[model samples]
Target: MWSNLPFDLLANIFSFLSPDSLACAKSSCRHWHQCARCLATPESPRRHPPWFVALPNRSRGLFCCAYNPIDDSSSSSWYMLPLDFLPIPTRPVSATAGLILLRSTSTTPFQLAICNPFTRQFRHLPTLNVTRINPAVGVIELDPGHQFGELNFRAYVAGGMSEAPGGGALDEPKVEMYDSRCDTWKVIGSMPVEFAVRLTVWTPSESVYSNGILYWMTSARAYSVMGFEIATNSWRELSVPVADRLEFAALVQRNGKLTLLGGKCGGDACIWELGEGDVWRMIEKVPFELGMRFLGGKGCWDGTKCVGNNGIVCLYKDLGSGMLVWREVADEGRWEWFWIDGCCSIRGQQPQNFQIKGLLLHPNLAHSSLLNA
Candidate 1:
């Protein structure tokens, strides 16, 4: 079989197959295994951008939907992924950067599973004992030198359980970082500020890493917002000028500036931008009628765009429906709406089914002009 087909051609065919298909192909025979393994190896030249978003489902558990911003016109392809192959918790938290990190259950010991869907390669991360009983997990890409071939990945687990039983209200947050290059974890230092004792199940208020800084909002038991810097390992109390009170706030980067978005404590949705000297300024108030809601709006900020769904309401409108609206602040800060359908939505009936666990964007299918040759 090896002599029959060109190895390069065979590798390209295997690259298009999902992880599950690759496994089956590997078992067919020795030749197939060699071909499959070569194609699945991390060093393979057929590596493609990880454009799939992992979503949780009640029936299928954790599944992934393919997303490609280049092919905005193509419908998204949803594929059910195998949870058994991965060491995922019952209530796992997932983050994507070529590889996906799945955090274990809250009650269980601290555990995580790092997976790369393209290569079907997975590594189970060891749990570290924490000072606090509950800790927050985050993933960030640091500047891995040119030797690693750009985008070296790492995971960080911050603010774990307090060591002392029945500790005071404020427990010092601890930080640990995992470097893929070294394939090990290290306790770096303690968080700059004290974290809330009660861990919120939702995503981190903000985990945007930019210019070597990871920014997130932490609330005390009193619900007061405190901002922290990961690079400098410092903490500070940030005053949100637009709202005296907020139910939840997320720190986002827009057009290269740090921004914040949240609903007022009284329930008015709003967006805020960080101005010079770290001053907070209100940019726009999202109208409730726009049908926008946020469950964990932390990852909503995708550079120039943000998307989230708390229930049926979505922050970004569908391009085909003529209802999806966006305000351009860098240009003129004017509101504009466009209609596009087929945008992913929370699947469920009314009332109890309104909760949206995930949001997905379709990929574009345009062929590269240079590839025509």
Candidate 2:
């Protein structure tokens, strides 16, 4: 059978395998290993359950934990990634299409780098045009129509605290983008000065890209969402559901749709999908018993944070209590939950004072043009 099929066709079939399975197949023999190398590029993107990455709060070392969604057994379900080979101290700000955008807190002007933790590939990027504190940042893959050989992407930084000439007033915020192809940064678009301040103060810098729009959960509670349409270079805001009553919430794009996962303190955690007319349609909810177990007598859900993309959404305690994940089964037309204990894999390596949070991304081990420089 192996001799009957073409080599390129075998590589294309290998691209359909899960990363873990593909790894096993690669190690089975030498010929398949070559096929696995061809799986590196985003040109033939593979499908794998988006895993939740638990990053230690402080960038003490270059080690972080990865949560495997497919593993349901009791064995170690996390991978402690040793990124010691990469130079400089930095933390991941955004991850898309297997590349992580890391920001260096040690430097002024906020140095950024693109690295693939899977392959130990690292490259430092040019400085952002604007120096901002808690800026809303995003890394989006610019569509190359699958025609170009090189991977093209854009990094965005919008709405953050910037220096002003006088101490008396607020400075207008600017939106800047970095092009991987050109290896340069340029101002793109911006929001209102007041709006940018609010986003900087309340919202996390992580942005979710869906279709042509980018969304960030704005405000302390699940009050509203700020959206930026890249095609139009415009900004828009939409109110979330049950803004006043919900104790916790997060805006995420899952299964290629903008969805919100949130819940009240004593109620079940719920999922809502945004449908036509900008309305939220109720989808699923965690059972009462499961919700209580997730809370674990915490007494409040305010510390919950949500991060997910594509076909998965993960809810975890900000204090590193544990993680509750819901993954969509496309063929089944249903969703399932997996609860991973937070204290399992990276316990001894972290101190009691440290906290951890997970960001969902499909890690690509392929070569990126961002590394060309």
Candidate 3:
């Protein structure tokens, strides 16, 4: 009976399906696959905002949950990621264009794997030659037309302790990259002498890719943002204002602009946009009332985070307070907040590894079988 329906009606019905459900529907039959392709087409109007995926807490196996508040408000409604094809004891360091960069837990030489959680497909890259405890990781998906199913992307891993197997600390900062097209890894660049001196105690964090540059925040003598131009393979550094205060700040991209989230001296969280000449201009602050909701009208916030997808920005108070997602009401000058009750309740059993972070991925009908390992 379903097969007798018109193609338009079938496409319309499938439009409402979530990423996982849509993947399953595509495999149900030939007609359904055709309908799924319509939604996956580059010009389809059924594109949905990326879902926020959180890493599992303590379980031995690698587990993840996808939270799409727009489709379901309840935390329990989030879907589990199909990571059966990926490596175990692995942690995701970066996510971009529907792909995740995962590193195995093996000691010394760390192997890398890139996977698309939505499609349940993954490709293993060669192991990184580093002996550092933590390294900054980043990825750039070169899908100009937003064709997510196509596995065309590059991954970068940089900066870690150069301690060799014999326990001698080399402390040499290195950068290596993997290109999916070439299926090979190459040494792109190394840390500048002047920059390495200041990075004696570097903190391994995830790098943010915006435009063609990848930015990583380093915590050493002072806070600094290190940038690497993927196309040119050049490097530069920008000092973060009053680095101590923004110690745990998160770097995120908003509509192609670089934004930083940090707490004020008084403890209120504020959002700043990167401006020309290495200057940062304050754009938004957590209203007093909103801060009071999380602060209990007493002390300052512990710390806050900002994550964005498309134009939507999610201000998260990692200290148990619920998330506040907002977007400029198209053409309206004011921003609006999306309240997802019980959103913060779903914490990972174990926190993500030091170098791994959560990612916001847009919904797509791309499947894993189509991509090569």
Q: Poorest 10 consecutive residues of model 1 by lDDT?
A: 364-373
How well is each residue in 1-373 modelled by candidate 1, as lDDT tens digits?
2233444336646766789998898788888788776653334432222233433432123444333322334343223344454434433343433344555554445666655443445566655645334466656654421211122567777664454656543453667787766666788776543343423332242355544556545544333344446667665555655444555555555655666666654356667767777787787776544423322234232212234211111243222121233433223545443223333432231112211223321121212221111
Report the lDDT tens digits of candidate 2 across residue range 1-373: 2443344445756776798998898898788888778754436444446657766554645476676555545435556777686677676677655566777767655567877766677888887776656677777877622422244688878887766777633544788888877889989877787678767787776788888888888766547888888888888888888877688778788768898877876666778888888899988887666677788865467778778877777788653466677877757978788777764534345523246556775544445444755
lDDT of 3 by residue, 46-74 (tens): 23455676653222345566676445535
Q: Itemize residue pairs with steric clashes in candidate 3.
A: 50-361, 50-362, 57-349, 57-350, 58-350
Sorting all predicted structures by TM-score, with the top scorer first, yields 2, 3, 1
Better of 2 and 3 by TM-score: 2
lDDT of 2: 0.70
Q: What is the lDDT of residue 23 in candidate 2?
A: 86
Q: Candidate 3, 232: how far from true, in Å?
A: 4.3
- The window of 10 residues in a row where model 2 has the poorest summed lDDT is 143-152
RMSD of 2: 5.7
What are the clashing pairs of model 2?
98-364, 255-310
lDDT of candidates 1 onward, in order: 0.46, 0.70, 0.63
On a 0 to 1 TM-score scale, where does candidate 2 land against the true structure?
0.81
Q: Judged by lDDT, which candidate is best?
A: 2
Assess the local accuracy of residue 23 in candidate 1 as a C-alpha lDDT between 0 and 100: 88
